[model samples]
Target: MSIKSEPHAGNLCNLQDRVAVVTGSSRGIGFEIARVLASQGCNIVLNGVSNESAIEAAAETLRQDYGVDVLCCFGDVSDASVTADMAKAVFKKFKRLDVLVNNAGILDDGLLGMMTQDQINRTLDINVKGPINTMQAFSRLLARSPSGSIINISSIIGREGNRGQVVYGASKAAVIGATYSAAKELAAQNIRVNSIAPGYIKTDMISAVPEDTHQERLDSIAMKRIGQAEDVARTALFLASDLSLYVTGQVIGVDGGMLI
Candidate 1:
């Protein structure tokens, strides 16, 4: 799809001609982020893992609704080979990559004692290694852009640590650590790296929590309401746009003051 650039109407950040790749963006928070970025004039690459039809539908929606070019790239973010190919396709199609949102991750919640080795490895591979793989693969393309932004979607459990989220928390913490290191390394190239730690948002992932546990989580939030995907999406817009030029290597929480 081709979209001619239009005059931006308001003080919202203008991201014309920019290309963004949002992994695991077929639905949920990643999808909302992709939509918001497309609205801001970015050409979006909607990525998914083994879901060609879903990813293609998402791409089409962005193309029709926002009139922005949308590309569909499907593969597991944990595999370096897969991400390498994804990068090649992005560069082939867009010629430039301005933003990369490593939003692909998996959660296998269980007590450390009950968690099998396979479960632990799967969580770490997807939640931690996935972002690292994509970052390494896209670094060269991101370097070509005048400004590049990398947003890693983390979780509140990663920071505060819940009873059943031992391995998941560790993986998310690793993401923050990677963000700091990557930000320092990429600063010279004018590429910003940051992580967004979302609280108990109303996504399919959180729906797995038991009803009683879920209620307790809701009561703990300062806002007393579950966060919408758009809440986190707006923060991503700030980081992706020039508004956050000075911001890098930080973990912004979208958990409705639950961390406080």
Candidate 2:
């Protein structure tokens, strides 16, 4: 199941006729972002490390539900060549790009003193270099779009830092840094870039944490509850659409007031 370049239905406001590429969207937060964007009338390009079939299924659901175009590309975004290929595939179908959400990332938990080189490299490659490479590959189309936007997914640990996640935190922190610099450089071309730092979201990524550990995290949030995928999805939609036109180069935490 793949979406055609042109939408098969009428356009809507905010994201009408816009095209958005969401990496790591097979499930979890990325999937929700694609869903919300499709509902807003944006054509979607879906990407993930593996699971081509799953991505295709998700795309098909979006197509059926929203009457919008949806394309699925499978590959490891951490690889520069793969990211370039993903961009090319997207342009081949859509002909133009309006928004990009670099949401693909991996986590490796270990004490800093005991972390291995492979863990460090893999975490940084997927969580940090992936966005940089994707942005570079897609900048041309974005520069020409009417509403060019780039939204990078960071984490609260990136800003506040955390134990047993030094490398992962570092990678997310790097994402914020890239967002700041890219926003400054791309603003002239009408390409808005920003980062979202989420905390303790109930995703597969955090399921490994013990119940007590998770509770501890929830207790710290001012909202006194965990955030849902929709929370981050809403934030992504804002940055991807005109709602955040005057906002860029900023790290907005979607952590239920956890950062506050």
Clashing pairs in 2: none
Q: After superposition, how far is residue 210 of candidate 2 from its true place, in Å?
A: 0.5
Which candidate should be chosen as best, given lDDT against the real structure?
A: 1
TM for candidate 2 is: 0.93
Model 1: lowest-lDDT 10 consecutive positions? 6-15
Cα deviation at 224, candidate 1, in Å, is 0.7
Using Cα atoms with residue i matched to residue i, what is each candidate's TM-score against the true structure? 0.94, 0.93
Query: In terms of TM-score, how similar is model 1 to the real structure?
Result: 0.94
Quick one: RMSD of model 2? 6.7
Tens-digit per-residue lDDT, 5-90, candidate 1:
85454444778889999999999999999999999889999888877898898889989998999988888999999999999999
Q: List, in order, the clash count of every candidate structure.
A: 0, 0
Per residue, candidate 2 scores C-alpha lDDT tens digits across 162-240 of 9888998899999999999999999999999999999878899888989898878888899898999999999898888
Given candidate 1, what's the lDDT at residue 252?
Answer: 96
What C-alpha lDDT values do all the predictions have? 0.91, 0.90
**Model 2: lDDT of residue 114:** 99
